[model samples]
Target: LHTGCIPPIVHRDIKTTNILLDQNFQAKLADFGLSRSFPTGNETHVSTVVAGTPGYLDPEYYRTNWLTEKSDIYSFGIVLLEIITNQPIIQQSREKPHIVEWVSFMIRKGDIRNIMDPNLHQNYDIGSVWKATEIAMSCVSPSSIGRPNMSRVANDLKECLISENSRTGESRDMESKSMEFSMGIYTEVIPKAR
Candidate 1:
């Protein structure tokens, strides 16, 4: 999703383990061995054999063998769910069997607290967590076309980060810069500089 490449690359595999963080806590995508570029000129997807971790693989891509950038988004969503719930991607011992299903069930029952990682100790902004959960669910939509592009996802998350950091006394200037860049994504709920 680094927008630098001439032809956009689809990271066929994106899991929590493959995302590396540096000393500054910046995340970088790794393991490009399964990456593929979108076909040149107006082509939206590339036909290929499905090759990604089982729990994180995009169901549409696995079923159709037509890979798109959305496949990565789906995988990223799975990672986000894992981070939020701190649960295994798939656990046969659980009735839901998959993280998504468990999260969905919780949401249906209006249990946001259960969906959140307890390690957070109720320190984060609830609105920000709600927004992040919404974004993650959107990313995992069953249809590829239903997924937001990575830029949109990044912008939405930037808003969530801004909202959450605003509570911890991060500088207003940092919030301002991020808000300016992502104004359109979450204008309704973006917290004002205090």
Candidate 2:
């Protein structure tokens, strides 16, 4: 999304379902019927009727109807929360039904552990998880202008991944060496057919 589209399009309706996983586990965003092209030079946000899914909609867009890139940032914040907690966007049974609200509440109280999905156990790097959670919170700030741009979000996620990998003491050099050693053995056995 950050690379493919020229002028960059907004998928007006970004939701977990709209993101599909390939056999290899690569994710692809689908369903573009409601997508809109970002405003061209000098134009900021298109003034259009609000269009998006319920749980994922940006409240700012719902109120003033001024659509900005920040609107997508807000929805992405929700997606980030879903990635962490594996919880539904709208928690119907809870007093704070919305996942954003619940997460924010937990973060404000410094009880991040309570916000995590129990299924994760201790398999994850707590530092990375906290960094990501903080980013997600910044994305959903009530004021649209308060949210970080998608590029910032992407870079921060990459940092979180790198940090997690470091915590596990996994090195890229080892992976490269393993691949090269495997290729050397395969070539030696095969010989040349000439």
Candidate lDDT (C-alpha), each? 0.84, 0.78
- The predictions' CA RMSDs to the true structure, in order, are 3.8, 11.9
Q: What is residue 10's positional error in candidate 1, in angstroms?
A: 0.5
User: lDDT tens string, model 2, 121-163?
Assistant: 8687877888888888888889988998776776666567767
Q: Candidate 1, residues 1-194: lDDT per residue as tens digits?
A: 52547677899899999999887676778999999987567787889998999999999999999998899999999999999889999989987998888888888887788889999998888888887888899899999999987778877787778677789878656545434443343335545321
Candidate 2: deviation at residue 63, Å? Answer: 0.4
Error of 1 at 152 (Å): 0.7
lDDT of 2: 0.78
Off by over 4 Å in 1: 172-194
Show how many residue pairs clash in every candidate, following the order shown.
Answer: 0, 0
Model 2: residue 183 alpha-carbon error in angstroms:
33
Off by over 4 Å in 2: 2-4, 171-194
Residue 24, candidate 1: alpha-carbon lDDT = 60
